[model samples]
Target: MVINLAMKILIGIPFVFGLLVYKLRTRHLSTFNAIENFLRSQNNLMPISYSYSDIKKMTKGFREKLGEGGYGSVYKGKLRSGRDVAVKILGKNKSNGQDFINEVTTTGRIHHVNIVRLVGYCADMSHCALVYDFMPNGSLEKYLCCKKSGIHSLTWEKKQAITLGVAQGIEYLHRGCDMRILHFDIKPHNILLDDNFTPKISDFGLAKSYSNETSIVTITAARGTIGYVAPELINRGIGAVSYKADVYSFGMLLMEMLSLKKNLIQNTELSSQYFPDWIYDHFNKSKDLEIGDAEELGCEERKITRKMTIVALWCIQMNPVDRPSMSKVMEEKFREKFNLVRGGFYTDEVQGS
Candidate 1:
């Protein structure tokens, strides 16, 4: 009887181990199928795919990390063509890997200059990653708020250009694409600067797409980071959520860009200051705005600063209906360009939108 019992116990061990192995393989296969199905439906717009081994070789065994954020750790990598790329290996999957699908589908079809391009991707079960052109300047957040003492402040011209670049990028997401993409997150941290300082919007993991005809979309919960999320998103009664939510976020970003330079040195600011309210009190007067560099802005520079400030205020209005559409917001830029051709400054008319 003892010999028979031992034989049965040894057989059960292998049977249970085999069963676990089979279940693990099946789980991985299911995830692979889900990713594959999404890619298959995207026509030919999807970026290149890399195997797990290729990822290791390109990233040099993940030796050089570029940065880390909510999504995952990004490592500097090189493509076969000798071009540099940033590979973001996503964190372990706790859900169905919906964020991976969201990013691939959202950015794969976009061909805008202001939006970041997805060069390739990997969906190797637990080792999924995204590849993109490495922005030499990194994120705009590095420059803003003077995170470190030695980091130089951006010039007014460059600051305005970044503001306009981000505006155009958000505008493209709202109007340029077949489906309106509402980038729920539009903070400075997500804005990447190339070697030329041209801002490219990145990290579309939290983005949502709706038909251009979708004026007011529904969601189960509010999206976007805490500081930048629109009022209507959190409270249903605030207003119907739409592309306007992105406008609200862009407005908040503009506020940060404007106030960051003054934040460190200015001692007169109120305790627990909300920038919009503080800036509003000081609006209409260039010196009162107190945008650093001794508040001694040149004529043209002052006009650009005020132009963006006006746009920013318009964006964060309490009611979504009151906020200007990106189309209306961007329309003023065309007029400003026309004025420049006629030797006129952007001027106060930029306030109309």
Candidate 2:
């Protein structure tokens, strides 16, 4: 029996290794051809293709690094047309090319003023990269966590406008697109600001899309940053994950816009009250707000600020059912109840698809 077991183990080892090698080889080949496959297929819009060598030339040998993520690093690059672009070069991961495929296909189909523009992509052999219009102001995160004296604090007007753009962008994903998309990851770091301080949603690596047939989806695993993940994603008992999950994440992001920068549960001495509860209580009672720099805002600006604050608190409600959907911004009930700005907070708005 021991001899038979040893013989079986030896045979199974080769079989397992061969199977892994086959899968890897298949993935490697598919990744090498993903761009071509995407090009031949039908899409709402067709972003051009770029060669790997072209990426190197544009990125100047990856000299100016802008940011890094679990999958890869982003570099500052300039296109031949003299346009500045941010290039994302995918890194090694066992997901093979699944993430690169998702990022390319997802961003390629959608276009909204608040959504980042996908200019082109590179998928030469195992090397893959995505090119996007460069955001001059970088991410909303730097401002949220900034302590540098040189970093000019964003005015109340700018803060509200930026968050409003982000909200609209997320709403577009949920309702405006041909396919309903849930941005499983929505955090300050994923929100980019252009020269005008208009926020554009970025980082589609974790995006999940559903057909117009259904708003609810059952993902195999929870997806989002630690602080921004909805309670439903973490505990099934809370609710089924759906578009509301994205709403919950946006709530967390908006809550931080009020200057609750750190996770209060982990960082604050106000153990008696949940952070959102504190904001809710203060805003309702008209108590003096210690939020960021709100005390200095003028009366009109403060009214707008407090109104948005209420919306933010409403977003972070513990139950997914209680939270408002992103598209609810369109409804009169949402408009009157949340008092979300009459028009968008920004002026001279232009949308590019």
Q: Cα RMSD (Å) per model?
A: 6.8, 6.6
Q: Global lDDT for candidate 1?
A: 0.78
TM-score of 2: 0.81
TM-score for each model: 0.81, 0.81
Candidate 2 wrong stretches, greater than 4 Å: 1-27, 30-45, 261-289, 330-353
The TM-score that candidate 1 achieves is 0.81
**Which pairs clash (backbone N, Cα, C closer than 3 Å) in model 2?**
none
lDDT of 1 by residue, 258-295 (tens): 77325633577463565444544444233344555435
lDDT of 1 at 183: 86
For candidate 1, the per-residue lDDT at 331 reads: 79
Measured with C-alpha atoms, the lDDT of residue 192 in candidate 2 is: 94
